[model samples]
Target: MYKRAQYQIITERLKESRHFLQVVLGPRQVGKTTVIKQVVNDLMF
Candidate 1:
């Protein structure tokens, strides 16, 4: 799981009014998908 600080940072960046794509990559089971889901959930469409 990502530390709260890091997750918030990414969330803040995504909140901006612009088209942005973030790519997360690492070894399998490193929580990349989990983090992406968290971000998507936190971000209101």
Candidate 2:
């Protein structure tokens, strides 16, 4: 399985205890949803 740089970045930020908005910016079809799903899955499970 391959993971993008954004995956690690997002995952790290999500682990933070502080509260803030994390906005992901990128062009279309760049697996934004995929990365988000991966982050959620790893953190939740």
Please give each candidate's TM-score: 0.62, 0.85
What range of 10 consecutive residues in model 2 has the weakest lDDT sum? 11-20
Q: How many backbone clashes does candidate 2 have?
A: 0
Estimate every model's Cα lDDT from 0 to 1.
0.72, 0.87
Q: Residue 4 CA error for candidate 2 (Å)?
A: 0.9
In model 2, state the lDDT of residue 42: 83
TM match of model 2 to true structure: 0.85
lDDT of 2 by residue, 1-45 (tens): 688889998888877999679998889999998998888888888
lDDT of 1: 0.72
* Model 1, span 1-45: residue lDDT tens: 445445776887777888598666679977777777777877755
lDDT winner = 2
